[model samples]
Target chain A: MAEIRKATGFIDWLDQRLAVNKFIKVMMTEYWIPKNINFLWAMGVVLMVLFMVLIVSGIFLLMYYKPDIKLAFDSVNYTIMQEVEYGWLWRHIHGVSASVIFLVIYIHMFTGIYYGSYKKGREIIWLTGMALFGMFSAEAFSGYMLPWGQMSYWAAQVITNLFGGIPFIGESLVVWIRGDFLVADATLTRFFMLHVLLLPLVILLLIAVHFYSLRVPHVNNQESEEFDFEDEAKKYLTGQKVESKVVPFWPVFLSKDFFVVGVALTIFFYLVCFHYDFAMDPINFEPANNMKTPAHIYPEWYFLWSYEVLRGFFFDIGGVAAMDIGLAAFGFANVIFMLLPFLDRNTDHVAPAHKRPLFFVWFWLLLIDMIVLTVYGKLPPTGNNAWVGFGATITFLVLFILLPIITKMEANCKCNTGGCK
Target chain B: MRELKILAVVIFFTAVVYWGVEPFAHSQMHPHVAPADFAFKDLGVNSKKGDAAKGAETFMSAGCIGCHGVSSQGMAAPMDHASASASFGVVPPDLSTAGAIYDKNFLAALIKDPTKALKVEHKFNESRPHPMIAFFGLGGDIDQEIADIVAYLQSIAPVTPMSDKQVFADACQRCHDIKYDKLMSTTDKEALKAYMGTVPPDLSMMIRSKGTEYLTTFINNPQKQLVGTSMPRVGLSEKAQNQVIAYMEKVGDSKKAEREDLGYKLIGYMVLFTLLAYAWKVKIWREVH
Candidate 1:
C-alpha cells in the first residue's frame, strides 16, 4: 500500500497493522459526492435509519409476541400493551416504521425516475433497488400476518388465493406456499421465518450492493454532463493531473445526511410516541376469525395501486378466469417496472429533470394513475370505481409502453432543433 | 460552531415535536378505539342464550314501554305517526318490525346505555339528543337483561319470514340497484342523488364486500356507524339485523367461515433471528470507532 499521508503514535501503530485510516480515508473522508444533490438524495440515509429502527423494535416485539393462533392476538393486543414494559412503544415503532419506510421508498423511487438515475451505468444500482423493493414487499406482507388480525388473515387468504388463479399447478402452488390446504400455523411459521430472517437478510445484502454500485458509478446529480469519477480517481492515483469539481463525502454530504436523519427520526419518534395508529387499519384490531371475513379485504395503502389493477379485470375471457388474467397482467406490469432500464433505451447521461421532458411527463402521469388506483382500490369495487380502475389500468400500461418511444422522439426532436449539447 | 448550533436547533425542534405536536397526533391516531377496549371479535359472542318469554318481562320492567310500543295495540305516547314524530323529532319507530331490523349486539348496547353506545359504538355526536337513557340503571347483570329484551323483541315481529331476495328487495332495492332490469328512471335517480348528496351504494355484493359485522352495526344506525351519513337511523331490532345478515350471507360470501386461521410461531422465529441479527451487527461493526 502507498503511504500518501503521515500518522503518529497509536494511529501510526494501527495504520501499520490494520490500514483502518486508509479504509476510512478512501470510503468516508476522501469519498466524493455530487454537490447539487437535493433532499431526495437524503432518503437513502433515511431508509438506512428506518431499517435500523425496524430491526431494533422488531426484536423487542418478538420477545413478547406469541406465534400461536390462539395466543397471537392476545400477545399483541394485551400482553404487549399491558404486560411488557414500554412494549407499546416498541410495537408502535415497528408497526409505524413499516409503513413510513415504504412511504420514503416511494418518494426515493419517484426521485430516481424523475432524475433518470436508472440510466446507463447505474443499471445495477437500479436493479438492486428494485430487488430490495420486491424483498421489502414480501417482508411487509409476511410481517403484516404476524399480528394474526382480521385484515392479516383475510389478506393472506386473498393474496395466496391470487396464485390459485394461475392455470394448472396453481392450487398445488398455493398449498405449497401456505404449507397446508389454507393459511394456518405452517404458513404463519414460514412467513415468520421469511419476514424476520430470510427476506431482511436478502434486503440488507441487496442494499449493500445497491450502495456499492451507486458509489462506483457516483451519485447522479442535477447536471447534464456525466462526471466520470473513476477516470479522475485513476489519474489522481497515478500522480497525474486531475480536475473535477466534487465535494467530500464527510462533512459536506455527511452533515446533510445527518440533518435529514435527525428530522426523519424526529417525525418518526413523534409518530411512535403519539400518532402510532395514523396509517393503521381499524379492522386489524379484531382477532383472526376463520368463520367471518371483514366487509372489505384491502392490502396496506402501498399495495393498493396493484390491487386496483387486479380488480379492474372483472370479466373472464373465453375459458380463463378474469382474476387469472388480472394476476398475469399485474405480474407483467411488475416485470416491466423491473426491466425499466432496458425498456428505456436512452443512452443520454442527462440527470436534469427538464432535460428529460418525456420521462418527466410520463412519470408524473404514472404517479397520478397510481394515486387514483390506490383510492379506487380502497373503495368497494362497484359503479364508478370499477370504471375508474379500468381507465387507470389502461393509462398505467400506456405510460410504460410509450416511455421508450417518447424519450427517443424527444431526443431526436432536441437534436434537430440544435438543443442537444 | 455553526454545526453545533444547527444540531442544537434540531434537538430542540425534535423535543418540541415530541412533547407538543406528538400528544395531539397520538390522540388523533387513536380516535377510533382505545387499546384498553375489548376487541370487536370478542364482542360477537353472547355468554347466555336469551329466552323470549323471560325477555318480555324484563322489557316492560326496563321502561321500554314508555317510549316504544308493540304494533298499535298497547301504547304510551299516542300511537299516531304525527304525535310520535312531534315527541321524538323523528317518529319513534314501532317495535313490531324491530325483530327484523336491529342487531342483537346493537340492541344490547342501545338498551343498556343509549347515549354512551351511540357516542362510542356508533360514533354519534355527543350533543345529539338521545331519547333512550340507561334502562338497567346503575348495574347488576345488565347483560342478561339486555339479552332478554333483545330476545323478546325478536319474538314479537317479522311474522312473515321473508326470503333473502325479498328482504334485499324491500330494504335495499329502492335506493340501490341489484339487477339492471328494475333500474330507477334517470330523473328520479338524479333527484335522489341530489337530495342525498351521494349516490347510494349497491347491495348486490354488500355482504361479500363489507363483511357481516360491518353490515350488522351499520344497519342498526347509519349515523352511529358512520357519522354525517345521510342514511337515517333505521331503528332495526336485533332480530332484524340477524335476519338481514343471514339473508345477505346466503346471497353472497357464504363461505366466509372457511377462512383459515393464523398462528404465532413467526414471533418466536423473529426473536431468534433478532438475537442472531444483533450479534451479527455487533460483530461486523466491532472494528469501527
Candidate 2:
C-alpha cells in the first residue's frame, strides 16, 4: 500500500489514532477504476450530488413545513415557496433533484446491464443498488405526499389501494400503511414521517452497503474486460499510469468525474430555472379535495411506465381478476432489474451489448418499450392509447422473461467455440 | 461514433417522451377551455361614452352603495361582512377598485343580470337563481347606466402599476385568502362555504398550478373552465386582471427572476468548471493507457 501523505504533525497523530492515511488510500487514492469507461458512469457521482441537494434543500423546506393535512399544503406552497426568503429556490432545487436522481439511477442501472456489470461476483453490488433504488423510490413517493395537493392526495389514494389486493392482509396492510381507512390526515402524517425520517435512514444505510459491495467487484467499464485491482494499484502507485489500464480514483478518475459532474449541473440548473414543470404537476398545485377527483390522474413521469403496466391489463384469466395480474406485472417490472445478475446466464462470451446481437436488440427494445409505456401512461386510457399501453405492457414482461433464454444461447454459442468453461 | 450512438439514443428517447407527454398528451388531457376575448364580445353590451363627473353622481343614485361599499369614497356597506354574507349569501365586494379590476362591458352585463354576466346561467337558472339582483339599468337606460357606473369605477381606480398584492386584495380578498400573504377572506368562513357550496381555493399557489392561460380563461368565465362552480365572475379590466394574476405569481413563484438569474450564473460557472475539468482530465488521461 502506498503512503497516503508524507506530511507530519497532525497527519502523523491522526494516522496513529485512526489509520487515516490507510483509510484514504483504500477509499480514494488506491481505488482503481477501469480507464475504458464513459460519462454514463459519472451518473453515480451525479446521484450523490443530487441526494445532497435534496437533503440540503429539504432541510430548508423542513424548517417551516407542517405535517398536518390542513397545514401541509400551506406550509409547502405558501411558507416555503412564498413567505420564506428564497423559499421557492429551495423548493425548485429539492423537486428537481428528487426527480432527477431517479433519471440518473435509471441510466446507471441500464449502463450496468449494457456492460454486464451485474453478472457473477458483482451480484451483491447490483442487489444493494436495487435496494437503494427501492429506497429512493420510497423516498420520492413519501416526499411527494408532503405537499398534500390534488395529485398528491389522489395518487396516494390510488397507489395505497393497490396494497388492498393482498387478499387476507391486503386491506389491513393498506389500513396499517395509511393509519386510516381512506387517505386522510393520518395517511398524510405517516407518509410525512416516512418521507422525512425512516425512508432516508434506510436509504443511507443501503448506500453504505452499496458502496462497500462495489469495492470488491468494482465498476464495470464500457468493455467487459476484467482487471486485477491489486496489480493495477501497484502500477498506479509506481506512477506507471500510461502503461496501466486503470486510473487512481483521486486525481486521475476524479478529474473525468468532475467534468461529467459539471455538465450534469449545467443541465440541472437549466431545468430548475426554465423547465421545472417536469417535476411539478399542475394538478398538484390545487389543494387536496377528496370530494372531487381530477379528470385524468397519473403518476410522476418516473413511475409512469410501471403505472401503465398496472392500468394496462383489463382482461380476466382463469377467473382471476385482470387487475391482480396487472398488479403482479407492475411489481415484476420493479423487481426484475435486481434479477438481471441471475438472468444473464453467466455468459463467458459476454462483452458489451453491441458485441452481442440478441442482447443488444433486447436492451434497445426494453428502453424504447419503457419510454412508450411512460408516454401512453400520461394519456387518457381510451381507444388507441389503451391498445398501445397493453401492447407495451406485454412487451415489457415478455422482454424480461426472454432475457435468460437469449443470454443462454449466447453463452452456448461462444462457449462452444472454446471449452464452455 | 460509439458516444454518438448513445447520445443519439438518449436524444431520440427524450424527444419521444417530451413530444408525447408534454405537448401531445397535455393538449389531449386539458383542452383549451376558453378562447381569449379582450373585447368581451359575448357579453352583448352596447358601447357608450359618459362623463366621469356624471358617473360619480349616478354611481350613488343607482343604489349600488346599498349592498356594496365604496371604500375609496368613504362609504361603507349597509351591513358588516357576516351580516351581509348571511343576507346576500356572500359578502358584497367593496367597489373601491371595481373599475380597476372588472371589464367595463362585463360590468355592464353583470349590472343587467348577475347570473348572465358571470356566465353561470347553466348553474343558476330561474329556480336556483343567483343571489344578486340585476341592476344594469338602475335609472332609465341599461347601457347608459352601465356606462356611467363603469366610468365612475374607472375614474376612482388607482392608476396602473399598483402593487400586485394590493390588486389581489381589492379583487380576490373579499372571497379568497392568500394565506402566504396573511390576508384572510373578508367574509366569514361558514357564510362563504354556505354560499359558494365549497370554500374557495387559496390563490397563493394558483399561478403555479392553474397557470396564466388557464387562470385567464377561468377568470374570464368560471363556467367555461369549471362548468358548475359557484364562483361568480369578478369583472376586472384588462390591466387589473393581469395585475391580479401577477400578484398570484408573486406569492406562487416569487423568486422566479432570482431563480432564472441564478440558473444562468450556475450554468456559466459549470461551463468554466467543466472546461477546467476537461483540461485536467485530458492531462490525466494522457498519463493513462
Candidate 3:
C-alpha cells in the first residue's frame, strides 16, 4: 500500500507539470481571447502555420544555394536539376506558400481595419503586425534575387535603382544596398544571408511579440451582434450553449487546413514538376552583359503595382527623373493603410454597415484603383496622350483624395444629427 | 461549431484560389533560352599561316586578350571545358586551340563574314551565342586578302600543328616592362599607318596578314587623309589615343569600359533610388502613420 501511494504521488506530480490543462491554464486563464471567436477568427492560427512551413523550407534551401551572382542562377538550377532530392519540390512549396501567406495576412489586416481591431488596446498588435508585414516583404525581395536569374537580376537592378529617385542620397543608398555598382556577387551573397538568416530571425521574434500583444486584449467579436447566439446555436449545432461550443483541433480545423494545404500542394507540385521554369535565360547564364539589356524589364508580381505606378508618372506631370517621386508616393500610400488605425479615433469593432461609411467606400475605391493601375501597367507608353493620364489622375484624386473628404463631411453631418451610436 | 466549420471552408478555398496558377501558366517554362540566333555553334578557331599572324594580331587588338587572359591562361570566368567545347558562345574563342580546330581558309572566311561564321562552322549544336556584331564591315568586297592570310597561316604552321607563336608565348619569360615607348612604337607608328592606309581591308582576301596590334594602332590613329591614307585622323585626343594604344598592348578590346560604365550608372541611379525610398519611408509613410 505504501509503495503504491508513492507511485501515485509521482504520477500526480508529472501530470501537474505536463498535462494539457497545465499548459492551457496560462493561455486560457490569463489570455483575453474572446470566448465568442468564430472560425473566421482562426486565420491568425492559419497564418502562423503557413509561416512555419516557409521557415523550415527556406532553411533547407539555404544549405544548397550559392549566392554569388555569377553562380546563383546555376546553383538554383543545380539544386532543381542535380543537387538535392525533391529540392525543387521544397522550393515550389516555399514560393507558393509565400503568396498564400501574404493573401491571408492582407485579409487579416483588412479584417482588423473593418472591425476596429486596431483601435484602443489592439493598437500595439496592429503596429507589430505591420512591422512583420514589412519585414516579410523585405524577406521576399531578397529571396527573389537568390535565383540570380534574368528576372532576378533585372528586378534587383530596377528596384534598387528606385532608391536613386531620391533627391540627394538616392544613388548612394542604392550603392550601399548593392555593395557594388551592379547586382553582382556581393549583392547576391548579402541578399542570400538576409533572406535565409537575418530577416527570418527578425520575423520569428516579431511574430512572438505580435502574438503576445494579441493576448493582452481579447479579440473583438462585435460582428456577432447580428446573429442571435441562442438561435444560431440551435440552428447550427443542436441546442448547444453558445459559450459551451468547442471541438478537437486535430481532426477538425486541422483536417480542413490540411485539405486546403493538400490542394494547394497539388497545384504547386504540378507546376514545379511538370512545368519547371527558373527565372534565368540561357544568355544570362554567360554572366551579366552590360552591352545588352533584356528587351523587357519588369519587376516580380509582388512589386508590379509599385512598378506600374512609377511608370504611370514617367511622362505624366513628371519627367523620367521626377517619376521616382511619384513611385515613392505610391509606395508611401500602402504604408498609410498600415498606420490608419492610429490616425483614426473611432472605436467601433464590427464590419457593420454604419459606423464607417468613409472607410468602406475608400477601401474599395483604392482596390479598384490598384486593379486599374495594374492593367495600365501592362500597356505600352504613348507620350502624346495627356488625356489618358489626366483621366487617371482625376480618378485617383476622386478615389483617394476627394472621396475621403466627402465621406468625412457626411459622417460629421450624421453625427451632428444624433444618428451615430 | 458548424458555422465555424463553414467559415473555415470558405477561408480555405479563398486561400487556395489566391495562391495557385502562375507557375503553370507561363509559356516557355524552362529557364529561358537565348534566341536560336545567339548560339554560335559553327565558330571554329582561325588556322591559316597566311593569316595566322593577322588572326593572332586581330585577336590581341580586338580586346579579346583582356577577357581571355595572356597566353589563354584563362581570366575572368566561364573557363569551363564543356562550355569551351561548344563551337561558339558569347565568350570569345580560345586562341590556344585555334591551330588544331579550324582550317586557315575557314579562319579567313570567318574574319570576312562574322554572320556566316556564326551560322556555319562556329556553331556547335545550337546557334550563335552572340549576334554577329560587324566589327569588320557591313558590306563591300572581300577576296584576295583572305587567300594570302590562309597561305601565310599554312606556310608557318599547319592548323593541325602547334604553331611557333603559341610556343613563343609559352617559352618567353613574361615581364612587366616600363618600356612602353618601345612597345608602343613597334606597332603604334608604322603598324597603325599601314592599317589606317588600308581602311577596312578586305578580310576575305588577305594579300599579307599583319599583326592585331598593327591593326588596332592603325584603327586608333589612322593617318591623316591629306597625308595620303584612306583612314582619316578622327582627331583623337592624346590621352584617348594612348588609352586605345595601351589597351591594344595590355588589355585590348574586351568589355572593361562597358562593365565599368554600367556599374557607375547603376550607382548613380541607386543614390537617387535610396533618397526616394527614404522619402517614402519618412515623408509619406511616416506622416500618414
**Most TM-score-accurate candidate:** 2
Model 1 stretches astray by more than 4 angstroms = A1-10, A230-244, A318-320, A414-421, B1-289
Q: Looking at candidate 1, what TM-score does chain B attain?
A: 0.44
Candidate 3: Cα lDDT at A157:
85
TM-score of chain B of each: 0.44, 0.91, 0.25
Please state the error at residue B175 of candidate 3 in Å: 34
lDDT of 1 by residue, B126-205 (tens): 56545455675425476776777789888875677766555554445445554312333222455446544556654434
**How high is the lDDT of residue A380 in model 2?**
97
DockQ score for candidate 1: 0.03
Question: In candidate 1 chain A, where is summed lDDT lowest over 10 consecutive residues?
Answer: A236-245
Comparing candidate 1 with candidate 3, which one achieves the higher TM-score?
1
Local distance difference test, candidate 3: 0.49
Residues A128-206 of candidate 1: C-alpha lDDT, one tens digit per residue = 9888889999999999999897889999999999888777998999999999998998988899889889998898899
Highest-DockQ candidate: 2
Q: Give the TM-score of candidate 2.
A: 0.92
CA lDDT, every model vs. true structure: 0.67, 0.83, 0.49
* C-alpha positional error of residue A331 in candidate 2 after TM-score superposition, expressed in Å: 2.0
Between prediction 1 and prediction 3, which has the larger lDDT?
1
Clash count in backbone of candidate 1: 18
